[model samples]
Structures are given as C-alpha cells and as structure tokens.
Target chain A: MTTNSISIGIVTYRTSLEYLKRCLRSISFQSALDSVGSVVIRDNDNGFDREIIEQAIAASGLDKSLVKVVEGDNIGFGAAQNELMKLSFEKGESAHLCLNPDAALHPNSIENVLEFASSKKFLGIFEMEQFPVPHPKIVDPYTFETPWCSGCSLLIPSGVYEATKGFDESFWLYCEDVDLSWRVKAEGMHCYLVKNAQVAHFVHSRSNDSKEDQLRALPLISAAKHLADKWGSPRFSKDMAKEYERRSGISIDSDSLNNVPRPSPSSLLKAQPDFSHMLVFSPSTWIEE
Target chain B: MRPNITVVTRTQPGRESFLETALFSLSSQLLVPEEVLVVAHVVSSGPFVELENLIGAYKTQFNSIQLLTHSFEGDGRTVSLNMGLEKATGKYLAFLDDDDVFYEHHFSSLVQALEKNDNAWAFSNVVRAGYGPDGNGYSLRERSQPFKRSGYSFLDHLYENFIPIHSFILDRDKCPSEARFNENLVRHEDYEFLLRLASKFPPYYLDETTAEYRIRLDGSNSVLDGSSGMTSEEFMLKREIWVKSNYILDQVRKEIVGWWAPELREVTEKLGRVADYLSTTDLTKRMEEQKKAQAMVDEIWSSTSWRITAPIRIAGSIAKRSPIPKKPKVHSLKDGHEVVNEIKSSFAWKITAPLRRVKDAKLKKQP
Candidate 1:
C-alpha cells in the first residue's frame, strides 16, 4: 500500500479574499502542509485575470508561489473539482480533499481524518463534519458510516475517485455529491464521516442579499431536477422541474430529463438512491435542524 | 467622522489558538477594521509572552494589532473589555471574543446599517452553536437561534440579554462614556454592557445572523458551559462563580435597572432564592461581590442620561418625589484617567467608597 499523500482542491467562484486567506491559514496551521500535501485553487470565475487570482491568493496569506492557481472561464463547480482532482492524480497524490473556500479546518483535522481513513482495509470517501453548523444528516457515532457524504469538506481516495469518476458535471452547484456518493456505495465502496475531524463552514443562511440568493437558488433547483432525473425518480424529478420553472420563471420542456446521463445497467442495479424523506434525504439524522 | 472600525478582541491564556482564528475572521471582513485590539487577561507574563508571539506572527495581515496585557484579580472579561474600550482609536467600536467568529460580511453589513440610521449602534443576529469533544478536537454537536432578534426593546433586554457581544458595533462619538463594561458581573458581562449602552442609544437591529456564538459542553471555554468533564472540585468552583455572578447581578440590578420595575427585581430575587437552594456560600465572598456590585452600579450611573437633559430632569424631579444630588459626577470613557485630578484624591475616594455606594444607591432608587 502507498503512503496516502493528500492533495486539496478548493473550487472558488468570486469567493471573499478574507475567507480564502483564512481557509489557507487553517490548512497551513494543521502541520507541515508543504511536505504532506499540495493546495490547488481552481478558479471558475467568468473572466478573472490570472494576476488578480494570484494577488488574491497572496492577500489570503499564502505565498502565491506555493499554490497552483488556475484561471479562465466559469467552468461550473463540479467540473472544476473533477479537473483539479484529475490533475492531482497525475501528480501521484493518493487522495484528494475537496475543500470549500469558506471552510476553516481545525488544526488536527487532516491528521485525524488521515489516521481514520488508513485504519480501514479498503479506503472509501471520508467526510469532515462542518463545525458551528453540522449538516442535519446522519453519520454513525461509533462506526462513522454515513448514508451519503457532503462534498463541502470531503476526502476521496484515489481508487474511489477513479471508480466513481468524480462528481456529475450536470450538477453545476448542488446534489452532485449525493450522486457521486451513491455511485461510490453502488460500486461496493464505503462512505463515512471522519468522526473526530471538523471544518468550520458557515452557510451564510441569513444574508439578505436577494441578488446572490437568486443566483444560488436557481442552480440548486436545477441541480435537484438533474439529480432526481439521474436517480430515475420520476416524482422528485417532475416536482423539481415544476419548482425550477416556478422559482426561475423559465418554462422548460421535459427535454431536461431525456438529456440526463446514466451508468451501465450493472451499476444501476447496485445504486439505490433514497428520496423517501423530503429536503434532507436520509434515514437517520443525528441532529435536528 | 471617518467610518473606520476598531475591533477589540479579549482572550485569556488558554484560548490563544481560538484568538488566531478570530483575527483571521477580522482579516477576512469585507469592511476592514482600522485597528485590532487584543486584551489578554493573564496573571503571569508567561502566557502573555505566548500571546504576544502568536499575535506578532499574524501582524503582517493587520497593520495595527495591539496587545494589552491585564492582570485582573477577579472576573477578567469586563475589565479586559474596559481596557480595550479605553484604547480603542477607531470612530466605531466592535468586539469579537476569541472563541466566537464573524462571517466576512459581518462588519460591512453592520456598519452599513449604522450608516443608514440615526441609531448609535447596530446589531446583527447571531446564531448559537454547541460543540463537544470528538477525541482529536472539538466538533460541533448542534446549532440554534437561541435569541429572539425581532422587536428589540431595552426594557425587555433588562430581563434577559439576547444579543451576543460580537453581534453589535457602536459609534464611539454617540455613546462615548456609556461604552464601558460592568466589571462586577462574572458571567453576563456582555449583557450588562449592552444594557448600559441600550439604555442611552436604542440599537438598530440589522436582522441578519452575521456572527456565531459558540459554547462548548465538554468543559471548555464560554459562559453557561462545561459540566460533563468538570471534576467535583471544578464543579464546586464553577458553582461558586455562578453564585457570585447571581449575587453581583442582584446588587447592580437594585441600583441600576431596578427603579422602573421593582417587580422584575422580585423575580430575579426569586431566581436568587433558587440559587441559594444549591449551597451555603462564603460571607467574605458575598461582601466582595457586594463591593464589585457597587462598582457595577457606579459604572451604570456613569453611563449618564445625557447631561443636556437637565431641563427634563428638573421637570421630572417633582413627579419622581426626590431630586438628584446637587453634584452628579459624570465620566466619559475617554476622560476616565482624569477622575483623580478633577475632585477627590485616590486615597479619599477609596476610604469613602461605602459612603459613596449608599449615596449612589439612594440616588438610583428614584426612577
């Protein structure tokens, strides 16, 4: 077995420089970052200059030379993450940590998660619990097995990423992680929460910026429709399509459902996506919302 | 006045790491603060040195991050806050405790709200999060909006403090003298400070949860925290602190907000009775709490109802049944140093402290 050297992928939109700097600072403080892992910032802004991105990285506390900053057109989130991880794989990193720009990891987060992941016979996807606000999803207290993993602070082993082929790019923003997690499980791999690790991720839930909210909400609704269609749940798909039209004020035909991609027949037989519970899609939740 | 914010962050020795996170939070704010003041209430120079080194490492991110070391003999939070308040040079003042955090937009949105309104201070909504031990480090257990943010009333605030310290920003020009925190209260220092500030300037509530209030249940830092890992001795010490807090609050309550609603005092006294049910306390400690309570009352009285409102005081004096003393010693936060030069020497003031407390209590008894 190879030593699991980690590579981090931070998919950034027009993220706050302060958030990015603090995020970088958090990762740096977690021990010797340079030796154990590499940090990559894959920018998905419409037209952010490379210089501006470099300056932002420097301003954020990272010596820009140490970080690999990629800049170009808005490639969408799922695609950017996939691209970064693939690049990391080529560089021989055993695992990829999909970190959000807004996340601040606890100093022992990486070390704890790595230790836990290595203890298992077959490595799977390990998710770091969000601090200050833990997601209202279930993760077994003792075993650390979760129904699905949120990509906000997820760790994917090289094998799992190669098998699942990363997040479905059809999902521009949300629900992509759920699809990928389900696929990982269907492939007979495990998914879990690294019980001891925490990453401080704030969902700016109460910020009254309707403009940004609208931009964020539309993609989320669109992603829901795509996810539902991919999972072969007609009811959820139809409902999400209707919701998309109502919320986005755009009329779309049933064309979106047909364009949805699918896995091989054998993989579909293994994949079982549950939509029984509305909003939060899981059987057991540790904390109430 | 220019709209630069001076963020005051008070931390003790153990919370140095948390303090680093807090400074990073400040660094990421959309509205950059003009200054950052970190008050370390360490009894020994060793912890203070560690804090100094830590702050020095992060000094590149902040042009002006000053560390003020305080050797507070008692409950240190309020005194630490007062120390920050004294040195704050920015036009507007904000506070972020070491353990708590602010989102990037926390300051920008607050300052924007303050700019739009005539109110001296504006507060954003803050969500409370509970964290516990997970072996490697503390992990968040749950989160809740424990405080009601709508329809803020200063009268209602007297009953309970719903606002977190980091949630609000005050314009120094508007409430200069009223800015000091009551050093007496061990637990609810932020609440006590808000009461005094809110009494004068009705804060503009921004109605957004831009900051977070974190509490650790596994015997960690923060108020109303730590019972699981606390040993019997630790529990008893914690119990005594709470008792002193209750006793001190009761003392200040009588001389401060107790005038308008005497019934409220009765309710608090009832709560005090409930605390008394727990254990028999030390009389010497009670006397110490009483003295601290008098100091708190003095701080509240010092948060003067504007000296400009003399005519109203004269008119309202007859209706209240008693007139104030001929001389009311008013101290602004900035002029805190000149009190000795103005009147009684430090020696005379120390000796007559009991006599002064009695007189102030009588004056405060009038609504």
Candidate 2:
C-alpha cells in the first residue's frame, strides 16, 4: 500500500441515492485518486441502500475490489464512521477520511488537503473547506489552526486516529468531532484547516415537521449534555438540560450527566474546553458576537 | 394528461448561468411541473441562441418546454410575466426568476395546500440566501428570513409586500380576468396583481420554506450588485422599488374593511378618554402657572405695602418668625370646569400620560 495513501470512509443513513451517486462520481474524477488506497461505506439503514450504492460504485470508476459496502443497523454517525475507519485502517492505509454522504469533493480537494496535512505531523485532524456554505469557524491565518474541524470532510492520519482512540461513541450524533479535536488539543496537537480544499455540501433542508425536529434535538441536546459534563462548563450544561427538558419533556438530573465520560483532570486543564460559544469553542473571527 | 402545474420562468437574454440552476431546481422537484415556459426579454435582434441551447438540454426532463421571446415598449418584468401567463395551459401557474431555486418539496407542498383549500393561490415560505463567489460556483454568505408571515392578510398586503414573488402558486380558473399584472407598474407588478386577486379570493399559506431567493453578492444578480458583500446598489434598488411601489399602490382600488367599524367604535371611545386626559395635562403650562403664583407672592412680600401689612400678617400667623411662609401654593392652576385636572399633578400626571401613550401606541400598532 502507498505510505501517504488515504482510506476514505462514508456513512449514509436515509441519504438521497442521487446525492450518493453524485458524491462517488466526484471522487472518481479526483486528480489524486492514486493516493486513495481503500474506500469503505457503512450503510446505517440496515443495508437498504447497499445494492444501489454498490451499483453506483461499479459505475464510479473506482476499483471494484478496493471499494466495499458494509451493512450497519442504524448506528449513529460517529459510531458508523468509527466502524468504517477501523475496516480501512486494517487495510493498512496511512490516513483516514470521514466524508459526509451529501458532500462531493472538488477535483483537487483530496490532493490539497493531503499536501497541507503532509507538511505538519502534529496535525490531529484536517478538513477541506465546504463550498457554497463554508463552516464559519475561525481559522488562524498564520497557523491555519481552527477551534475544531468539521466531520463533513474530515481527514486525519491513521496514527492520530489510533492515538485519539477515534471518536467517543457516546456522542452518537453531533459534537463527537469537537470532543475528538479537544482531546487531540489536550495531547498538544493542532487541528488544522485547508482553505484550498473545497467540498460541496448543501443538504440543509428546512423541515417544518416538529417530530423530525424533536428527533434531531434529542441527539444534539444529549451530545451537549455530554460536552458540558466532560468539559466542566456549568452554563452549557444548564442550558442544554433546560432545552432538553423543554423539547423532550424529559428532565435530566445532574446525576445522569456524571455518567457521561470525562477526560482526566490534567487533560481537562490542557484541553481548555470553551463552553462560551454554542458550536465553535475557541474565540473565532469568522463568528461575530 | 398534463401535470396541471406550469412554471413560468422570467429571465433576461444573458442569464444562462443562473437560469441553469433555476431549471435544475425545478427539474429536481419531487412534484415536477410538466409545463415550463421560459419567457426571455429580448431586443429586436431576435432569439437568444445560447438560452435556447440551454433550454434544449433540459427538454427531456420537463414534459413540455417552450422558449418564448417577449419584446415590450416599457421597462418592467410585467411583459415577460404576462406573456408566460397567457401562454400557460396549466390549471395552476407559478413564477420562477432566473436567480432563485425551489426546494424538492416546493411544488408538492404548495400544490397540496392549494388542493386542500378553496383559495385562488397558495404560498410557501421562502428563505433568502446571501451568495458570494467562491473558487467553486458560489458561497452562501448567510441565510435570513427578511419576509416571514404567519398567514395571508389582504389588509397587511395593502401595506407592504411580505411575500416574495416566487414563493407563490396561483390557480388559473379561480383567478378573474381583472387579476392581470399592471403593466404600468415598473416594479411590484406581482404585488399589484396579488392585491387584486387576494381581495377577490384570499390565498392559503404553507408554513414550510420551499424555495431559496438567492441574492448573489458576486454582482451576478441585478437585484443586488453584491460586490464586496451586499452593496449600496441593493439599498439603491430598494429605494427605487419603494418609489415605484407608491405608484403601483395608487393604481389599485383598496377596500376599506367595512366590518371593523364596530370594533373601531369601541376604539374611538377609548381614544376620547385619552384626548380628555391630554388636553388638561399641559405639563409646561402648569409648571409656568405655579412659578407665576410664587413670583406674585414674592412681589407682594417685597413691596412697601406688604412691609406695612407685615404686622397684620404676623398677628394672623400662628408661627410668625418670618413674614413669608416656606412654600406658596398655586391656586390659579386649579380649573374648576375641568375635573380631570383636579387630581394633584404629582402622582396622576406621571402615571396617566405614560398609560395613555402606551394605549395610543397599541392603537397605532393594531394593523
């Protein structure tokens, strides 16, 4: 296997098949496909879309043996990514990329992100900038270090993935990447962003369904509770508890939050988790007060 | 059978790039419109070959696609819109600008809304996106809801346009012949038509944002000369639109809601009390009157006659250490005819006016 090669992992749950086909088509057109050693897709909808995805892969111009689809039983995004990453890492690929199913890569996106990450061994996680709606999290121009990298097009070396022990599956849905990045930061590693790399991700559908919103809110608020408990931020914890109760009508006691996993006290001190802002932790120029 | 939905897209001759996205959005619709009429504004030079070629590529996606060329004497979007509507054979009609996009469920949701209701038209919520050029096609700067309404109100419609033109789908049979766009209107022709149509048949409102109104900050869009962000050209265009809107508003005969008179009668009675409270409580006038009374007493005390009468005042005074009392009361400020003013100025004066101001402000915001 190539030393600097990447093993791309994509997780899909009730994703548009058209969007999936488009995503694979974009990857097949990559200028640096030589750097991609393996590709694994985890279908979190119990292999419902596996046949369609397989057909898409067959047409995608990627090697039939190199790309494989695995069935998943609706496991959460972070957990699904972890499973896919493990499979690819076992294949001896040097780097891991957790790409969103909705995202389509630019021709040079993989080449640019890999080049940027190659020069920096201390990089815990690096990601391509999303096009049309780039993440507004601030990046230091001099250092190219952001508060955290988005899991939308996350790229990290397999060694860093092992050192971080991958994402804490307790996160289940959102903010797992943030927890991972903070943990990486605690170990004195930087999470960098590549502006030259661009991925097209436009799946922000505004659903008027209150039930669907509530379903989304549960995982989000649960993750928030975990983040607040682990980071020792009373404000974020209190706010999430209040919101979770308001939305779900289920009160979460302080005792329940203690069950959430926490970093060591020294790791907590080093990570310096900022619960000041909602999504992006450190002070960022991109987001205005 | 025809799909019964006609998407009347109004575009300029040179807008092939933006028109592609607009067409792509329509093509991607869950309930795709079978009929698409692309009405382009053209000069005497005839058809836009590039636009025709672009439409040719998407002909297989749509059921029946027609590229219509319209040449009008005056400058306005009404010409293209009117031609599209006239040529439209669908029972339902909709308008899509070259720059905007419909969500997958946009057509399906609004169609459902219209199907359920007896309304002449139905509108779904539309979000506005601020777009700037990235290395890729375009980067969305931000999304904001500049126009969000709970429901449709004909009275509120008379005041200002809260609905974007593309957010709505209108029924052809339910609409009267008089509900045509006012060609005299250089802008807000849709608003003018909506005013007339809504007066006759109140529309239904779908509470889902099914379309995106893109304001290209890259200056590609004429609506916003979005160079270096949302520029002065946007404000300038709005200024021009409002000025034109004034003319459009005057052209239509607005109905005076006759049923609200009974409620207005109660409002008038409350206003009378507010007027009665305001007339008596002239604050500066009362302060002046008090000052004048104090000065008169001071004048009398400083006079030689007052000095001569000091002995009588001292004899009359219970505490006669000084010729003058500590404070003089103003009797002249008391108006016997006005009972409202009889209440002492300190407590009633402060609380009453503020309450009335709140009352009047509430009344002003009623519409």
Q: What tens-digit string does per-residue lDDT give for candidate 1 at B1-367?
A: 4438898998987777788768766765556687999988887866466788878866665568888988888668788888999888888899999998887678878888888898999887887766655445665655667664456866557666678889889988788565577676668888767776777679998888788887664435753344544577876787788788766655655566655456875575466444543332666665555455445445533433323344555566677778653443322211222332232222223334345446644864574
Candidate 1 residue A67 C-alpha distance from true site, Å: 4.0
Question: Which sections of candidate 1 miss by over 4 Å?
Answer: A1-7, A12-30, A36-51, A68-73, A102-122, A195-200, A208-215, A249-272, A283-289, B1-74, B86-92, B97-99, B115-119, B131-142, B177-179, B216-367
lDDT of 2: 0.73
In candidate 2, list every pair of residues with a backbone clash. Answer: A132-B140, B217-B226
Q: List A-chain TM-scores for all predictions.
A: 0.88, 0.89
Error of 2 at B181 (Å): 3.9
Candidate 2 lDDT at B243 equals 85
Per-residue lDDT of candidate 2, residues B111-209 (tens digit): 888888998889888877766443345555567665676667655566557788899998888888545687777677887788777777888988888
**For candidate 1 chain B, which ten residues in a row score worst on lDDT?**
B331-340
* lDDT, residue B314, model 2: 54
Local accuracy of candidate 2 as per-residue lDDT tens digits, A161-264:
78887888877788888888888888888888887787766545455577777767787787877778777887888888888888889888663344556688
